[model samples]
Structure formats: C-alpha cells, structure tokens
Target: MSMINTEVSDFSVQAYVDDTFKEITKAQLLGKWNVFFFYPADFTFVCPTELEDLQDHYEQLKEIGCEIYAISCDTEYVHKAWHDHSEAIAKVTYPMIGDPTHQLARAFQVLIEADGVAERGTFIIDPDGKIVSYEVSSGSVGRNAEELLRKVEACQFVRKHGSEVCPANWKPGSKTLRPGIDLVGKL
Candidate 1:
C-alpha cells in the first residue's frame, strides 16, 4: 500500500545525537517538517557517502524548518561507533535513530526481513505528521539530498498556496501552474 499522505505511526525510539543518546517519538515530530531517512545498516558501503551528502545540506534543510532523522536497523551504540570512527558520519549533526527491533523500518515499509536490514527510504513529513512525499530505492542506489530539499520546498510552497502546483524541475521562485478550465489542454 502507498504510504503517501498517511500519518506517521506512533513510535518511540532511542537516537544518537551530538555525542549523546536521546529518545525520539512521533509526537516530537509534530508541528515541524521532518525528514525520515532510512538506510540498511551502519559500517557498510555507500551509506557513509549518502549520509555525508545529507550533512552538506543539513543547514539548508534546517533553514527551512525541517529536522532530519537518519534511521537504520542498527542499535544506537552502533550509530555512535560509526560516528566516532567515520569522518563522514562524524560531521553529521542530525539524529541517528536506532531501530534495533525493526519497528521503525517495518512502519516505513522498508524492512528486509530476511536480511534484517532496511531499504533506502526517504519520507518527507509535514507538521501535521502526515507523509507528503516518499521515495523507496534499492539498497545499491544512493539518493541525492539536494533533490530532497527541492521537493520539500515544492511541498511547502503548494501547502501555503493551495491553488498553485509546481511543475517538473520546479525550484523556488519558479512559476507554478494553477489548474483551471481555461488552462485545460493549453500546455
């Protein structure tokens, strides 16, 4: 089933952040934009690069009032270890959530039960806790954080201006199309 437009399920999990461990919950995500980034595991190929890429854009995402949460099936201890060892991961300021029981991965529908890992899943959730956009990709394929930021901008734009819609490759300050009878079949 499609997860788009669905409210995030109730969950409370431990997360490693800023050299300490803290608890995070669905309720905490309410009233702010959030990015739930799910990866397979820690200490693997391709994951660090993707995480660093996200770190590069973390400030921009925060400027737009979005908090990023990087999740994996690994435990919080593992997350901290990776952060300590990996320079790429060490630069990350966002929360790294530990889903040891796979509850989060299962809720996001990215769990690989056989392998006990999660697929690459990125979910953009609105302040109301409803998922507005999501992308699920294979484990081997890495995602671009810049593109995710663009989509968030578009989603925010459409939310504020209900009548207009962003077109393909739409960026901030770009023209948006408004659906109307006169514009039908014109494009």
Candidate 2:
C-alpha cells in the first residue's frame, strides 16, 4: 500500500546534534514540516556524502519550515563518533537519529532485516504528521538535496492551493495545472 497521506507512528529515539545527545519524539515532529532521511549505517561509504549534501541545503529547508532528521540503525555513540571524525558528517547541523532498536527503521518500512540496516529512504511529512511524499532508493544510489527542497516547495504549494497540481520538473513560481474537464486530453 502507498504510504502517502498516512500518519506517522509515534516514536522516541536518541539523536546526536551539535555536540550534544538529545531525545527526539514523534510529538516534537508535529506542528512543523519534517524530512526523515534513512540510511544504511554510520561510518560507511556514500552515507556521509549524502548527509553532507543535505546539510548544504539545510538553511533553505529550514527557511521552508522543514526540520531534517537523518536516521540509521547505528547507536547514538556511533553517530557521535562519525560526526566527530568525518569532515563531511561534521558539516551536518541537523539531527542524526540513532535507531539501534529499529523502531524507526521498521516504522518507515525501510529496514533490511538480514543486514539490520535501513535502505536509502526519504520521507517528507507535513505539519499534521502525515507523509506528503517519500522516496526509497537502492543503497548504491545517492539522493540530491536540491531535488528534495523542490519537492517540499511543491508540497507546500499544493497544500496551500488545493485546486492546482505541480507538473513534472515544476519549480517554485512555475506554472501549475488546474485539473478540470476542459484541461483533459489537452496536455
């Protein structure tokens, strides 16, 4: 089944952020847009690059009222160690959630049970805690943060203008379609 518009389940986990360990809860995610980025593990290839890419766009995401949470099955200690050691990961100012118990990985349905790791998953959640958009990629592929920012903008735009829909490659200020019988078969 599609997870679109589905409410996110309640969860509490430890996260490493800004040289401190913090507890994050589902309740905290409410009342604000959220991006839940799930990856395989810590101190591994590809993960740091993807994380740093997201960090590069963090300011723009925050300006759009979105909070980023990068999650993995690794422990909080491991997350902290990687943050301290890796130059790429060190650039991340967002929260790095540790899903050691796999509650989050399982909830997001990105867990690889055999490997005890998460896939490359990105979920865009609305302020009401419902999932607005999501993408899951193979471990070998990396995601683009700019594309994610565009998606968030599209979601926000669609939410505000319920009658219009974003078209392919739609960027902010670009034309959006207003679906109607007159528009049918016209594209």
Candidate 3:
C-alpha cells in the first residue's frame, strides 16, 4: 500500500541526541517537518556513511524548518556506544532514535523481520504529521544527503504553495508547473 498522506501513528521511543538521552514522541513531530531516516543497524558500514552525509547537510535542513531523526533497530545504548566510538557517527547531531522493539519500523513498513533490522528508508513528513514522501533502498546501497535536502525543499515548497507542483529535479527558486495554467497549452 502507498504510504503517501498516511498520518503518523502515536509512538514514543528513546533517542540519543545532543549528547543526552531523551524520549521522542509523535506529538513532538507535529508542527514541524520531519525526516524519519531508518537504517539497517548501528555500527554498520553504509549506515554511518549515510548518517554522516546527512550530518553534513543537517544545518541546511534545519534552516528550512526540517528536523532529521535517524533510527535503527538497535537499542539506545548501542547507539550511544556507536556515537562514542565512531568518528563519523560522532559528528551526527540529530536525534538517533532507538527502535529496539521495531514499533516505528513496523509502522513505516521497513522492518526486516527475518534479520531483525530495518531497510534503508527515508520518510519526509509534513507539519501535520502525515507522510508526504518516502523511499526505501536496498541494504547494500547508500543514499545521498544532498538529494534528501532537495526532496525536503521540494516538499516544503509544495506545502506552502498548494496550487503548484514541483517538476522533476525541481530545486528552490526554479520554475514550478501549475497544472491548470501551465498544462493548458502543453498537452
């Protein structure tokens, strides 16, 4: 089933963030854009690269009113340990959510039940708590943060301008397609 426009369900999970441990809930995600980034496991090869990539662009995402949450099936302690041990992970400043119970993973439909991990998934949710866009990649592949930033920018632009739609490879300040007006001549 398509996850588009699906409201995020109520959930509270432990997260390691800002050099501390805290509880993050669905309620907190409301009133702001959120990126629920799920990875296979903590301390893995590709996961850190992706997280670090996101970290590099973290400020840009926040400047546009978006918050990123990196999640994995590993426990919070493991996440903290990885943060303490790895140089790449040490640079991540966003919330590292611990989905040990697989509640969040199952809700997002990215859980790998057989392996006890989540697929590499990226979900962009609006301030209303509904998912606007999502993508799941193969376990062996890593994603690009620059692309994720572009996706968030596009989502925000569409949310602010309901009548317009972003075209392929759309970036901020670029021309957008107005379905009724722009398509009148073009087919």
Return the TM-score for each candidate structure: 0.97, 0.97, 0.98
**Residue-wise C-alpha lDDT for candidate 3, range 23-132, written one tens digit per residue:** 99999999999999999998889999999999999999999999999999998889999999999999999999999999999999999999999999999999999999
| Candidate 1 backbone collisions, by pair | none
Residues 44-82 of candidate 2 have per-residue lDDT tens digits of 999999999999999999999999999999998999999
Candidate lDDT values, in order: 0.96, 0.95, 0.96
Rank candidates by lDDT, best first. 3, 1, 2
**Colliding residue pairs in candidate 2:** none
Q: Which candidate is the best by TM-score?
A: 3
- Among these predictions, the greatest lDDT belongs to 3
Total clashing pairs for each candidate: 0, 0, 0
In candidate 3, stretches whose alpha carbon ends up further than 4 angstroms from where it belongs are none
Q: Which stretches of candidate 1 lie over 4 Å from their true place?
A: 185-187
Candidate 3, residue 3: Cα displacement in angstroms equals: 0.5
